[model samples]
Target: MAERSEEVKLLGMWASPFSRRVEIALTLKGVPYEFSEQDIANKSPLLLQSNPVHKKIPVLLHSGKPISESLVILEYIDDTWQNNPILPQDPYDRATARFWGRFVDEQIYVTAMKVVGKVGEEKDAAVEATRDLLKLLEKELVGKKFLGGERLGFVDIVATLVAFWLMRTEEVVGVKVVPVEMFPEIHRWVKNLLDVDVIKKCIPPEDEHLNYIRARMDRLKLKSV
Candidate 1:
């Protein structure tokens, strides 16, 4: 694998699932980087400078040039390493993998968040929609060990929400958003994904994440009231 002597830094918030995706990818690829914690509420000049458009938590700085957005960062890291390839080699297979990765973000994660953020009928609708989306993903993973198949790849990395975020969100909301029996494939995939050393190590501390979600839930409740 090629090595870069230029500095690599990750500007991120500790409890951010998006940031976790990039950290996990870099770790898997054996890329060395400095992690600078960003207080997103009190955004630093550097953070603002790095991602002026979105002002997002994760901004991967490669030799001072910034790459914003988690999914894009994952692809960039995979392209840089080329050893522990995340995306598929074949063009069609690569496109398929990218599609699922996008689905996890655009469809699954976004809808699942609504299940917790909303209340009563709205929350119920969001939960049902999320379930239907998961059903599609489960079928997609019918005979596969991972979404990327046989190993943790781009899609598996994108699923940091299932492996880490969802549980904390469920705990705070006082609902089992994704019941294990109902989504057995997702549960199994999450288990396998977390078993990987890089993924496991990149996960934020449970208590910290739990507290963060609890605070967010409290705010959501206040908003509803």
Candidate 2:
């Protein structure tokens, strides 16, 4: 009910990279917020009401109004808080950033869901598909420190899944999709991205992600059997 611009409340899950995006954005911009961790399995009333359509986590409640979806929330944060700009100053560059950000979220992250907890041929195919996508991203990262070049921005935020989540998931599933030697640029970009204090703080501990993915992989293995 508070109307203060800084009264940002994020309803998120600790293991979700999407939730991490909002947290990192807020932290990078120096905007303080109260985080309410949600249990997705049980589904909280607040999360349902805030995002009734999808019932998803990472909902941003700003001054009583809720904004759903991680990418949209990132844009809103950048627009509302002008100090730490996430998008580019030039219109064309901003459009380019948005394009790759959306590509990473919709294409890369969505495809990754199929690879995790999967087995046999399906898992192999998924990994190959996901790798193809990552190769394109690696080309984009060539000759750049981050997606936006020199600093982190929209594309970098969306690609955070690869920087943090992918490695942990690979360990849990006992697979190697994004091999550092193969995707050297992405590997380097990931290290550079995580070096930032905000990103380092917001990224869930590797063990936490490992446990979560291990549980999911176990369930998938049982189902396959």
| lDDT for each residue of candidate 2 in 86-201, tens digit (9 for 90 to 100) | 99999999989889988988899889889866779999999999999999999998999999889888889888988888867888777889998889998899889768998899
Question: Model 1, range 1-225, lDDT digits (tens) per residue?
Answer: 334724789999888889988988888888888999999779999999999999887999987899999989888888877888989999999999889888989988888888876768897888789888888887877789998889988888887777689766777777787788888888888878767888879999889889888887788778878
* Deviation of model 2 at 176, angstroms: 0.8
Candidate 1 has a TM-score of 0.94
Clashing pairs in 1: none
> What lDDT would candidate 2 get against the real structure?
0.88
Candidate 1 C-alpha error for residue 82, in Å:
1.4
Over 4 Å off, model 2: 1-5, 223-225
Ten contiguous residues minimizing lDDT sum, candidate 2? 1-10
